[model samples]
Target: MSFLSSNPRLTQNEGLAPAYNSQSEQPFAKPPVAIESYIQDLIEQRYQEQPEASVVCAWDGDFTYRQLNNLARSLVALLSAQGVAPEVFVPIYFEKSRWTVIAILGILHA
Candidate 1:
């Protein structure tokens, strides 16, 4: 069956709001997940298993974790030279391209 048909009640106006609300109300609670360290641990594990695996790939080329890290560092340096601070929200308006990917990675690394 199609997704919309499977959840037929959602198609009705009265059924829409509470069905959404019921999904969100969970009595049991779990510990909050730490995402940053989790991501770092996964990266470390991947590097340990296959040091040559690519982390970031673009239309121009594939960049390994080490290469992306180095590129990010260099871009961060360039951004620093232009007086961008750690907390500053620099608006990046650009057409989608490899440079945009590099800029995003650079910002994350910074």
Candidate 2:
């Protein structure tokens, strides 16, 4: 099933941020089982846990988690400002790269 099929809240465009974080008193009751369910959260955590880790490599060179998060956040701000909404289809055609990953996370945030 699609994330849109499972997460009714997607239609309402609520809870844009990750469900749990270091500041939370209690753990998020259910960590998203499907990798696609909470990609922004997962990527953010991965960056915090290991920012220097190599997450991408293209003709330009290697890209680290920190770079990916930074790119995604930038994309998020642009996309959110453009009124991108949850569960809405957005066509992003690009070859696989750190940038594409960033776009996915940004779309999630949007």
- Candidate whose lDDT is highest: 2
Candidate 1 similarity to native, TM-score: 0.52
Q: lDDT tens string, model 1, 1-110?
A: 58667776653344447765655565235556667664445654675677677876677677776665567679989988888887888788887655675687677555
All candidates' TM-scores? 0.52, 0.59
List model 2 lDDT by residue over 1-110, tens digit each: 57757785653334444443332535565585655546567777888999999987877577799888788788878987888888888889987665677777788888
Give the Å error, residue 74, model 1: 0.6
TM-score of 2: 0.59
Best candidate, TM-score: 2
Candidate 1 clashing pairs, residues 3+ apart or interchain: none
In candidate 1, how many Å is residue 63 off? Answer: 1.1
Q: How much does each candidate deviate from the true structure in C-alpha RMSD?
A: 6.3, 14.8
